[model samples]
Target: MRILIVGGGVLGTLHAWQAVERGHDVVQLESEPEARGASVRNFGLVWVGGRATGAELDTALRARVLWERIGERVPGLGFRANGSLTVVRTEAELAVAAEVAAGAEAADRGYKLLDVAETKKLNPALRGDFRSALWCERDAAVEPRVAQPALRAELARSGRYTWKPGREVRHLSATGVVDDRGERHDGDVVVFCTGAWTGGLVRELAGEPPVRKVRLQMAQTEPLGEELTTSVADGDSFRYYPAYRGPALETLEAGQPQSKVAQEHRMQLLLVQRLDGSLTIGDTHEYDQPFAFDVTEDPYEHLAEVAGALLGRPLPRIRRRWAGVYAQTTDTGRIVHRERVADNALLVTGPGGRGMTCSPAIAEDTAEELNL
Candidate 1:
C-alpha cells in the first residue's frame, strides 16, 4: 500500500515510519521545512507513571515501552528514562497525592509513592518543602525537535519512508490529494495527521469528535548545571495534561483539596531539566477557534515562581519562550482507530496533547488499518 500522511510533525513522521515497517510505501508531507506546532514546543515527558489511573494507566505503560523501543532504534534524540516525580509540598498536597497513589494501587498500577527524603535521594537536585511524591519509574522524556527529525532521518537512511518538507497540502481530490501548488498525488491511503490543523481538512465530514485547538505556552531558563533527572509536576500544571491526576480530578468534589486548587488555578506549573542543563517549563492553555503559534510571557513569571517554590531555589533567568498549538479532544485518552471519512480515506488524528509519546502505537494501528 502507498500511504501519504499529512502534516510533518511528530504524528506524520511516526505514521510514515509505521507504514514503512508494515511494508507499505509511505511519504510524509510537512507544510513547513520544520515542525511549527506542539511537536517541538513541549516538555517531552513520555509520562509513564504520574497518569497511574484507570485504563489509561495500561495504555501509558504500553506507550512507555514503545518509547523505549523507539529509543533503542534511534539513539540520542534525548530519550531519558529518568522517570517522573509528582512532588507534594503541603500536608494537603501529600494527602491528595496519597489518595492518587491509593487509587492507583487499587487499579494495580506500577508506581512508587515516595516520601520526601526518598525523593530527594532519587534526585538530589530537588530540595524544598516537599513531603511525598508519586514516582513513575518507567517514565521517559524525549527532545521532540531533535528526536523527531532524527527519527525521520533514520527512516530515510534505512530506506523505508520518504519525507517531503515545505509541501503544504491544499485539499483532497477524488482520486488524489492536492498540494499547495494544486499538485495532486494519488495514494492507496490518505491519512490526516495535521494535529491542530485537522479541522480545516475534515470540516465537511461532520466529525462528532470534539477536537479543539489549544494554545500552550512554554519557556526555557538559562543553564543550571544541576543534575535534574526527572520531569516534575506541581499544582498549576494539570490543565495541560490532566491525565497525571487520573480519576482524582474526575471525582473531585466541593471543598476538596484538588477541587479547590483546580478551581483557583487551572493547573500547576511543571518543570523538566533538558539534557543541556536548562530547565524547560511553562504551558498554560488557551482555547482558540483557529489557533495561532505565538507565545506570551505573562504566565511565565507566576509559573517560575511556583517552580522556585518547588525547588527552594531562586528562579533562573529566562532565556527563550515559545508557544505551540495542539489539537485536543474533549475525551482525554488518545485516538488510535481510523475515522470513517467519506469515500475510503481515513482521517487519523491524535489530539491528547501527546502526539509524540502516543504516536508510535497510533501510527502502527494506522498502518494495520490501511492493510484492511
Candidate 2:
C-alpha cells in the first residue's frame, strides 16, 4: 500500500513511520520547508502524569513505551526519561498533591508526594522554599526542535518513505493529491495530519472540524549553568491537569488564587532544560479567537518569577520568545478529531498539547483502523 500523508509535523511523520514500518510506501507532504508549528515550538514533554484517566492516559502510556523503543533505534530522538516535579509552596497546594498521590491511579502515573528534603534530594537544583513536590516518574522529555527531522531521516532510510516539503496540496483526488506544483502523487490512502492549519484545503474537505485553536507563549533562556535533573512545574499547574482535580484541589483553588498576571493570562510555569543547557519555559493559554498578533510580556514576567522562586535564584537571561498555536478538540473527552472525509481520504488532527507526547501511538492507531 502507498499511503499519502499530508502535513510534515510530528503527527504526520509518525503516521509515515507506522506505514513504512508495516511494509508500505509513504509520501508525506508539508507546506513549509520544515515543521513551523506547535510541533517544534513545544516543550517536547512526553507527559503521562497529568493526563486524565481512561483513553488519554492509556494512549500516553503506550506512546511512552513506543518513544523509548523508537529512541533506541533512532538516537537522534534525544529521548530521556528524566521525569518531572510539580512544586508546591502553600499548604493548600500540598494537600492537593497528597490527594492525587494517594489516588488509585497514582501507581500507573508514577505519582509520589515528596517532602522538601526528598524534592531537593531528587532535583538538587531546586533549592527554593517549596513545601513539597508531586513527583511523576513516568514523565519524560525529548528534543522538540529536532524530533520531526530526526524521525524523517530514519524513515528515509527505510527506502519506502518520501518527504515532500515546500509543497502545498492544492487539490485532492480519489487516488491521491495534486500539489501546488501541479504534480500528482498517487496513493491508495490519504491521511491529513495538518496540525493547527484547519483552513484552506482542510476546511474545503472536512468543513469546520469540532476543534478549536489554542495560542500559547513560551521562551528559551540562556544556559542555566547547572543541571535541572527533572522538568519542573508550579502548583498552579494543578488547576490545568485533570489528574489533580479533587476536593483538595478545589480547596487550593478557592484559597490560593494565582497572581493577577498569571490569572489573567491563564499561565503556568513549566521549565525544562534543553540539550544545550538553555531552559525552555512557558506558558499561558488563550481561548478566544482573533488571538494577539504579538507575544505579550506579562506572562513571561510571571513565568520568570515563579521559575526563579523554584530555583532559589534569578532566571537566566531569556534568549528567545515566541508564540504558537495548536488545534484541540472542543469536545475534551476525545483525544483527537479523526474522521473519514472522503472515500480514500481521512483527516486526523486536534491532539492539542498531546501532539508531542502521543503522536506515535496515534499514528499506530490510524494504521490499524485503516488496515494499512
Best candidate, lDDT-wise?
2
Tens digits of lDDT, candidate 2, 179-261: 99999999999999998998898999999999999999999999999999999999999999888889998998888888999
State the lDDT at 234 in candidate 1: 76
Worst 10 residues of 1 by lDDT: 253-262
- Tell me the deviation in Å of residue 230 in model 2: 0.5
TM-score of each: 0.88, 0.99
What residue pairs are clashing in model 2? none
lDDT of each prediction vs. the true structure? 0.70, 0.94
lDDT digits (tens) for residues 1-372 of candidate 1 = 777888787877777877777677777888888887888888887865544255456666666777788888888677878877878665555555666567635334446779878989887878877778877677788986697788887888767577788888777766658888777778877887777665555665545556767677788999877888778887434323444454444333223444333333344577888878899986666764555545544577677777887788977888988877777666555454347675657776644565666777667666666663
Candidate 2 local lDDT, residue 61: 99
Q: Give the TM-score of candidate 1.
A: 0.88
Per-candidate alpha-carbon RMSD to the true structure: 3.2, 0.7
* Per-candidate clashes, comma-separated: 7, 0
Stretches of candidate 2 above 4 Å error? none
